[model samples]
Target chain A: MLHSFTIHRAAALLRAGEISATELTAAVLDRIYAVDNAVKAYLTLLPEVALAQAAAADAAIAAARAAGTLADLPILTGIPLAIKDVITVAGVRTTCGSKILESYIAPYQAAVVDRLAAAGAVILGKTNTDEFAMGSSTENSAYFTTHNPWNLDRVPGGSSGGSAAAVCADECLAALGSDTGGSVRQPAALCGVVGIKPTYGRVSRYGLVAYASSLDQIGPLAKDVTDAAILLGAVAGYDPRDSTSVDLPVPDYVGVRDQGAGDRGLHGLRIGVPREYFAPGMQAEVEGAVRAAVELMAELGAEVREVSLPHTDLALPVYYIIAPAEASANLARYDGIRYGLSAPADSLWEGYRRTRGQGFGAEVKRRIMLGTYALSAGYYDAYYLKAQQVRTLIKQDFELALQDVDVIACPTSPTTAFRIGEKVDDPLSMYLSDVFTLSLNLAGICGMSMPCGFDAAGLPIGLQLIAGAFAEATILRAAFAYEQATAWHKQKPAPG
Target chain B: MSLTIAEVEHIAELAKLGLTDAEKALYREQLSAILDYAATLQAVDTSAIPPTATGLPLRNVMREDAVRPSMPREDVLANAPDASEGYFRVRAVFESGD
Candidate 1:
């Protein structure tokens, strides 16, 4: 089916003139219509906008072909993709999965969105997210829960759950998701797709609607490593508008991948098995799948060594502190007077309180209150500053480990997707779901989650590969090597 | 590290969120548990360690001070809850007849 085509395959067909962008887009839209009611991946569908973009892409392709400059066009042209609702799209409703911005129309687009448009990528629509991208499960969305494409009863993992689910369901070729903590990778792990959280500052955060400025980063969730590499190559680079965006030249990920295709076997690749990542109480099947995948990497000519990040256990506390503290400051913009929901009250202060109180969901409010306490007077030094210091220790751990190994291989999540509502009421338990994936964001390094194997019930397990900052190419090559050696990447969820 | 209802309310007030009593009680319990879990950070001595606020070393990123096209005031104010002539209208900072 055209809906199942990867970005590379679809682009090849479009370049070959065997399929029009419009036809490919229509097939995806038709699939969305057929399965979205059961999956609920999207908060808003852009059928009209997508078709318009597809038509424009077709024109561009035709013109390029006529001029014999088809090779010069970006690979993203005419590739339909989904955007997490947290990203702003001009003239489109960007809800961020919150009632606060339920009716908010973005006045301007995000830097990443502009890049996608420049690449002639067709945006399918905005997918569901945790309110303000705060929770691990999409159940925290003000809208509705995004059911896992593999099993509707289980969650897709989250904050970026909907984006992951959409990709797994073949609703789109690939999708963009913002990761704060494990928002991107964990969901990708649970949903059985490839998701990468680029090193901090690898992608622009200009219009991401900040959840945690220091922790949040935009990355891709796709069917395979190559598609992820293509999408990452398109969106990654220095942006003048984002202050934290690194000024270094963006690596040509696809070009590098092609160049390394000759050495696809992981010959001499140093793979570090972080002993801390394989925590107790993790599902046995999940651990077995990941360990087996690591052994495969070793057998494929990679050197595997056990490593330790002694402070790894402290990452969760530090993340909860730093993220919510930043969120408390960032989300303060949603007063009654500004864009989004405003509940009128007799006094301005009352209005502010009421609007925020009513607009934010339970998880958001919990985090905000926790952050307020952490940053409030008398507690700032004890909570926030202490977390930052510990955060330094966490970052140094990665630096010291990467000094020896090229990449760290671990399980993306402790377990596969859990049943919806199983941990909704228990915030701490939900937070534990991200144990294996959180340190990458804390350390400001790149990491990816690709399917390694499935559990007894058929849910997918993800093998996480971590690399140093701006070393996305290394992880891509490693994941691609593993993917080529295994059939896991080709597995897809049945139609919802 | 159990939080009281009053502490929860105080934190909520500091955050500018007006919560119902039920919410306050609920958050009192949840926030307390999360904070209790976070108390583990205290065991790690950071006396000599400097705090890391950002992931990258770059700071104060300045773009060329070139004037570019800005969003139209109409468009900017279009999403405002209340607006007047070319401005976001808000309730008077001080009550009238004060």
Candidate 2:
């Protein structure tokens, strides 16, 4: 139960001297030891490092209490959190779930990691991910596929699969995941936890290894909306280290909702129901769960209306084209000459060829090739350029719809978590899985996924909430309201 | 635009990746399928739309040109596959048409 405590609850106990950071961290480490064998959520577990941090947090908390500075204690003090392997943690191995960086230790911490450390959070370790954050399932990881906690046979949706699974299984209190093309939201949905992908520049991308630089945003995966909000607040800010990070102010997100309204949750909040998201071919049970959530929003004193993101159908192709094109360039840094796996050959060209050829996995190669082909001569205008134009239309579609609504509601994924290798071979089919969530990234807006219901198989289905750029407070408030009104977030997976 | 084995191989070479024969065949199949599916973009008339490199509006992100501390040489070379004299060492490329 110590591992299950939310940030706010844990903070109160730690402040009152009822529970120490070491005790909570040990509980989480034990939980990971007990469950990670079946779940396979973590790529690395830093027991020694985590215990040292826990001890540091305890000392800091004690010093603050004794000095009458307890009021200024960091909210995340003593909380155990997981970092996705893609985010560098200085001396920790930042594998990004690829063989190329299997032995790669980052030279510096990410801006978010620095912020979290300043807040006194304990890092559990690196969680597994799709190689370079490219796949819908962790199956694409050169390391290992992270199994769903609900059912070991199924995958936790990815490339943030390990992060979501860790949060859901209580391997750690919460986790950070990069949301590029629904990586965070989809996995959080599958694992039955809350996940938030802040507005594109809301969180700095300083140390997240670039995979589609334009689309990637570091976000939080936690047991509930409040915890996600806490973790989000800890990292959401402008950093001079990242050029693209917004100069806009980061509000007190955890306290944002508490000021506005009374018990009539989401009153005067207009929730847009994007009709295209509930289009044909989607799973019946998934649509049913989302529809039920919409109806519940209506009952909770929200004005709900059907809206449209006309470019919804084009999101998949747009994402595939644009993401790969960017990834193609982003991943080019891994040559035998630099940090990471290097295969020496007779010449420089051969070294580049062999190192990349041997280091990258099949899906990574497929994407790289697809990206190269798209950006190649005689095809750049046809594929990559057109996808960019359509991307504008997609952003326009969201902007048009959002003008009339505070937040848009949709399903996180078209379906629940699938079997491990179900659609990996059919690349297009797998790409379509993120149809509902990809456009938000394309629009550079805020979105989150929280549990709405369970399928007949008892798999978790996610309800997605979308808001305009830097509107995390609105999304957080609306989500917290719905979360408070429902028992769905209370559901936990059976022991794996 | 179905990609042939030659096309796949060409792309692989351009990307500095050496694909095995079987991988080239598989990529020819998969990449072609993906490319063919991606051709749907041609149906949309995007003449009026400007391409978006990122969802962020175009702006020259400038910072004060101030010198700052950098990573230590040891830390910089920590993960290098081949390092000599505190620098990344690579194979010679004597006029191999980069």
Candidate 3:
């Protein structure tokens, strides 16, 4: 019964009294208990808290019924959600998949969490992430790696891998994820779910642990486009607490849920296919799947054309330099003195040294060092400053291209999820996997990934749709339309 | 393009992450490969272009200066590793000359 119900469907059932919020919450918890051991999606589970929230939601629904105030409301009233470990939930452990923060409980809820709670959404638990949201796969998590539900041996992308995998595995109805550099979309692509990375500042970041502060944006992961929309509507808005949050009006996300491909499906919608994105060495299956999606868009009435982002080649390099430089600065606040892990040592400096040395995972420490070097005195101008210049050109490239197109389409990842330990030894190869998706972060644009097709191994392939700044509606409309035309998103991985 | 052990140590120090010899060697190898791959950006030229730090067009957004109610001290220290009497406790910093 739980397997077939999405957030919208479950919410309707709960509102109609066909199923109580307690029953819905129990079903999701049962699914988590049954499958999470093999999938390893959740980092922490608070069943008592979840059930308590479910009870509260049930009472709220009952009171609203008595007052006749439940006529028209949000569609996610009683749905369950999994929060990425990077986002704070008051009283829950927000580890960021790092040992340094492993025991650190959040003192206050993130703005997103507060909004979701206000909308009557129940947070089941916190999901795993790369330590400080640093890696391309969940293997970087200090606690545990999230396996792809499709094939337990393969990685579910990172650093929001657990959020993606949890939704894919039906561990939660919808989950929140953050994208610094394709963390949300790439993981969604790998886990075979719909994930959206709202435009920079489109969603508030207050209470979200800082990681590459300028690039990180929190968004949603869900089983389908409508579910993603419902979740986004609840969390996307301005917050006075978050200085970077945009003050733009929140659109009616669910209002446009059924917007199918219009008469000019592909005809008037200029879709750009950057040659740089389809470079040599890209997996044949990935390229084929994305091209097939473009063709499907054309059949639906959209216009497709080859476009050039001449500076595309510089994106990954610039992203690595700038993201790490920011990370180094942002992560500096985590010393033994403040919170979480602390190691005993002879002196204060030694204690700070030993704590971080023992607390941070290898990949995280490596990145901090690299980022620090890039921003250091003698090398700052050459590395950090130069990277910033290239970041601008990357943005200019997008601005130039968007002038001629409505949205850009590409493969979410260069290839599908790789074996868990395949590139763990080679950081460059791992970073290159994000080549197609990083530019969106640097440009502060919104992008989403939906299951397009499956490779020969039955692994899911994701087609990425990127829109210009604050153009989420256009992207969501197109993705929702594409999803309506296809059944790829309906295919689920067989239980391990 | 490969980074040396000493360079890795220097970077680690700059980053404030204390690394042991074993970790430093490992990072030296890893960072070298990453830096080598990142060097691909050097081929692109941008002599006249200005660096962009953000994507939004709006800047210099300021709010009226006003004080607001703050969180309770207990709530603020609920997760601190070391706290006492509504204050964050930390090791005392010594004067550099001392």
Candidate 4:
């Protein structure tokens, strides 16, 4: 009943009338009921709403079959999906894992949510995240922490931790998550799910609660590469509402999926192994796993080469500066005057003070203060401006490296998931968790993390695939080939 | 060591976050550690580099100044915590502070 059905298998089953959408949705819902108590992945669940959507999908499949419109369609019809807390789903609470927005119900759906609905995916629930999507671990969630499905004692990476955990636990067939500095990919790697962070502006940020505006892009968390591709095809496109949304034409992601790795799969594909990515501090097991994945690609006919992104070491400091600076500005709207939490006080200043004081979590408040200081009057030139300059150098480094390679491969995180409270008290260590993946975001490039191997403790380690801007098809093809060759992606966590 | 209480308060004001004296002391310590760590950026030598604020090279994306449709006032105020006749109601800012 709980085999890891790839998107293709699930779609075929639904189309053949062998499995009703209602039955699939009920199964996932039952799984959630069975395991969510231990994982705490979902912030909210909508069983009735999901069941209704599933029934509708079943009817649509029947009607489409009768009308002969069922052939050559988008893949994800009748699939149940979970959404990150940061992405708004109209009429659902979009807490963003913060006390500030704990009671806030989005008046409108995020553009990604609208597209997912259009693709006939059922909305199962909203998942938890770090407050304001500001932390690397879901431990910063003001309400609750999403436990790693592999081992509940460890963390599911954040701010997409809950989304990854939900998919890992089989609570949902697929989920949508946003990545800013590896938020989506890191957790996906930690939780052993396929997480894709589409190139900046590849997917619309219209209703995504802003966090590092230019750096944030919405993508998918799925059980496999095919599902991630199907979900990305549905959500990636231009949107007039978002000024930063790219007008580039969305590619036929499903076409790329069906093409698979063919004879030329990884043949002649120039894969760059960045020296900075394999620096001295990376965990030995992680380095071993990444090397094995690279070797596998080499055996598959890819020409592997050593490359240097000289400015790569600067990515972490630069990202922390710029992301927080933008977040400080983006989060300004959540003042006491708007919806969400508001603490009553005698005067307007006092009210604003009390509201914000009680609303934001400790880590969020720390980041906001840090960001505000960086962008403040006198310090702007020294901190924020310098970081921006370094960011350019980092992007240039990627551009130079891409000249020699079509794609780059590395470990998604320095190590696998750590214990829940391990890095919560140390901000620097937590920030460094995204070291390998941050450069891709700064360069506005697409990247994905696929299950490559497991740590000594049996925790999954993710191997990252990064490509130049708008090279998602190539990245997905390579990941698909690797996933097909390895059975790591198929492993599931035992229910507690 | 790097951040003073006054600097912390100044930053708190900029962020619109209120802090108690005790919290201010805590931030002074936390901010000191963070600022010291962030000091590593100073070694990068970006003296002649241009700041990159966005990925796209395009500039001047301004729209034409033309009249456009607007949302109904009722719809605009639908989600307001408190709304009065044609406006958002809020706690009075001042009763003549001077």
Candidate 5:
């Protein structure tokens, strides 16, 4: 099926004139029509817009072919991908999985969207997310929960749940997702796809609906490491509009991975296995699978060593404090005075209260209250400031450890995908699911998750590879090496 | 530490959220649980550590101040709940008697 083809493979076919963008997009649209009801991955499917973009891509490709310059075209040319709802596409409804912006059309597109368009990529539609990207499970989404494609009863691991599920179910070849506390990597792991959470400031966040500014980053979810690398390169770069966007040349990610390394197999690579990441409560199967993957890497000539990131346990608490505090400040713009849902009241204060209370979901409200309490008068130093100081310790831990090892390898999530509504009521339990993935965000590093193995129940487990800031090429190369040696990435889920 | 119902109400007011009494109670319990878990951070010896507000080494990202075209006012207000004459409408901030 065209939808099953990876971005690189599809691009090669398109360049060879064996297929057209229109055929690829229609196949994906047909797949979405066949399975979206059960998967609930997309909040809005832009069939018309996708077809139009596909037509345009075909024209560009045809022109390039006639001019004998087909080889110079972008790698993402004519590739169809899904976008997480948190990122906007101008003239499309971007709900961010919240009711407040249910019918709201984006006034401007995200920098990633513009870059993808420049690369001749097709945007299938906006996928679901945890409301305001707040929850670990997509159950927190106001509209509907996205099911894990591997097993229908399990969550697709959120807040990028929909994007991950879309990729796994073959609804889209690849997808764009935002990660703030493991939203992208965790979901990608649970759904058995490759996902990258780029280093902070690596990708411009100009049009992403803010959840936690300091931690938020746009990334890619795809069928394999190569596709993830391609998608990441297409969207990554400095943008003047986002002040936090770093001014640096994006590395040739695919080239770095394929430069005689596919067969070299991680020779001379230093892989760190942080002892803390394998702490208690991690599923036995998960720990075994990850350890086996590490052993395999060691066999492949990687210098595997046990590294210590002592402040790892504190990442969850620090993330909760920092993320929500920033979220409260960022979400303040949703007052009734501006766009989004407006609730009727006699006075502006009442209007603000009603609008937010009615618009935000339970998890969103809980975080807002937590954030308000943390940043409130007489408590800022104890909560927010304390978290920041601890954050320094956490960041230093990675810096100190990475000096000895080139990349850190661990389980992407504590376990595989959990059953839906499993941890929904207990917010703390839900928060714990992200423990393994949150530290990278706190340290502002890069991480990618790819399938390591499957459990006895046939669920997928993800092996997370992490690197220091702007060291995406390191993780990509390591992941690519691991991927080339294993057949885990080839497995497909039969979504119920 | 556990939060009182009154404290939760106060926080809701501060956050400009009109929560029902049930929501306030539920949130009070959940928030207390979260805060209690977060209390573990106090055990870390961070007294000598400087706070890091952002992980990146970015500061004062100033750009050239020059005239540039902005988004059209119509597009800007296109999603507004209520707009007239290119301005957003909102509830009155004060009572007439005030």
Candidate 6:
């Protein structure tokens, strides 16, 4: 029962003196111990560390209340949060789901980890991800695959699969996931939870192992929109440590959400239904559910209209080129000379070769090789440069569309959670799984994936609400309205 | 364009990854297919557009040239596979093909 509480409800209980942080954390750790063997949501569970943090949070909260300074109590005090393996946690092993850093402990805290720690959030543990956050399925993880909580045989989606499954199964109050392309939203969609990928620069990328620098963002995954909004408020602010972090004020997302909307809906909101997002091969169930959701929005007093993003067809090609190009460069740092796995060799060059050759997984190697070719001499102008130009066009398409509509509505993925290993062999098919959610990252804008409906098999379908840069408030507001009107967000999975 | 095994091997080498013969062959097929799919971009008429290296239009980001607390030596060497005397040991890198 404690594990099922959202961040808001859990915080309320802690403040009301009805529950101690230590007791609440023990309940969550118990849940992880119970279901994580089948779910495999965590790479490592920091139970001793979590319990210590819980005791500290309980003590601090009690001190604040006794001093009659309850208002000074940290918002995240006692809240349990899961960190994806890709994020650095000082003094904790951060593998990035890759053997290259399998036993590597982070030397320093990531910007987000520092912010969360300052807020007194209890760090439950590190969740799994694609090795180096490359593949769309957790199958790419060097260690194991994370099964969807809905069906034990199906994938939870990835490379944030572990975080998504963790939240969906109530193993943690909420989790942090990094999105480069659809890593956050796609997995959340598949697992039937609320996931947000804030505008590219909204959250700092420092200490988030770079997959694709330009596209990477850190955001929250939660059971409901309000909890996501609350979690977002805690860690989102300009950090001078991250040069690319935008120097803009982070809004009180939870505050705006609780402020009454007179109509209990998004009145006067304009939602654009992109025709291109509903491509020919999209599953009929997904299309029907997303269409029905738009209809519900129309009934909720929001204006729905059809729009086209012509370059939508170019997104996959463009993403494949740009992301790998950046990854190839970023990942070059894992030389045997620095940190991580190193193979002894006769020469330093051979050392670099053997270390990388043995350290990386299949998908990681494929991207690196493809990227090396794309950025190589004589091919740069044709492939890499061309993809960049197309990327500009893709960003412009969203910029122009948002001028007419407040948000773009579409399905998060083309299908529900497919069986594990179904698309693992076909890299192209796996790459195409995030067709609907990729362009938002390219445009460097905000987006949220919330449960819209489910298919015949009971697997969840996600409705994606994408907004302009720094428009997380609008995205959260619209998502909250829809979430309250439907019972989907409240649905819990039968944990394995 | 189809990639030959030799070409795959060459690309793998350029990426500092030592691939086996089988890996080269497998990559030759997979990379060819991915590249062929990427060749679809050539059909778009984009001669007039400029490239976007980053999603945001970032200017030259600069800060004061000041020193800050750096990672401690022990922490920096915490995960190194080979380390000694406050430094990382590696095969000699600058022996000019002697």
Instruction: Give the lDDT of residue B34 in candidate 2.
Output: 83
* Interface C-alpha RMSD, model 4: 1.5
List TM-scores for all candidates, in order: 0.99, 0.98, 0.97, 0.97, 0.99, 0.99
Name the best candidate (by DockQ): 5
lDDT of 5 by residue, A176-208 (tens): 999999999999999999999999999999999
Error of 4 at A337 (Å): 1.5
Per residue, candidate 1 scores C-alpha lDDT tens digits across A1-496 of: 9999999999999999999999999999999999999999999999999999999999999999999999999899999999999999999999999999999999999999999999999999999998999888799999999999999999999999999999999999999999999999999999999999999999999989999999899999999988999999889988878889987788888776676579668887899999988888999999999999999998878999998899999999999999999999999999968699999898889999999999999999988998989999999999999999999999999999999999999999999999999999899999999988888898899999999999999999988999999999888878878888899988888856
Candidate 2 displacement at residue A472 in angstroms: 0.8
Report clashes for each candidate as comma-separated counts: 0, 0, 7, 0, 0, 0
* Stronger candidate by lDDT (1 vs 3): 1
Q: State each model's CA lDDT, in order.
A: 0.93, 0.90, 0.87, 0.87, 0.93, 0.91
Candidate 6 lDDT, A243-267, residue by residue in tens: 8899899898987667546667778
Q: What is the C-alpha lDDT profile of model 2 across A19-110, one tens digit per residue?
A: 99999999999999888989999998899999999999999999999999999988998888999999999898889999999888899999
The DockQ score of candidate 6 comes to 0.85
- The sequence of per-residue lDDT tens digits that candidate 4 reaches over residues A215-307 is 999989998888898889899998877888878998877677567545636776899999888988889999999999999999988899999
Greater-TM-score candidate between 3 and 5: 5
Which is better, 4 or 5, measured by TM-score? 5
| Model 5 alpha-carbon drift over 4 Å, by segment | none
Off by over 4 Å in 1: none
- Look at candidate 1 and tell me the lDDT of residue A443: 86
lDDT of 3 by residue, A1-496 (tens): 6734799888777778889888889999999988999999999998999899889889988888888887655566778889999999988888999989978988788999999888888889999998888988899999888999999999999999999999999899999999999999999999999999999999999999999888999989999998998888889999988888899999988776444534524446788888889999888999999999988987877788888898888899999999988888888888877688878776677777888888888888878888988888887877888888899999988999999989899999999999999999888889988998899999999999999999999899999999898889888877876888899988988656
* Superior by DockQ: candidate 3 or candidate 4: 3
Task: Tell me which of candidates 4 and 6 scores higher on TM-score.
Answer: 6
Question: Distance from true position, residue A267, model 5, in Å?
Answer: 2.0
Q: What is the lDDT of residue B85 in candidate 3?
A: 80
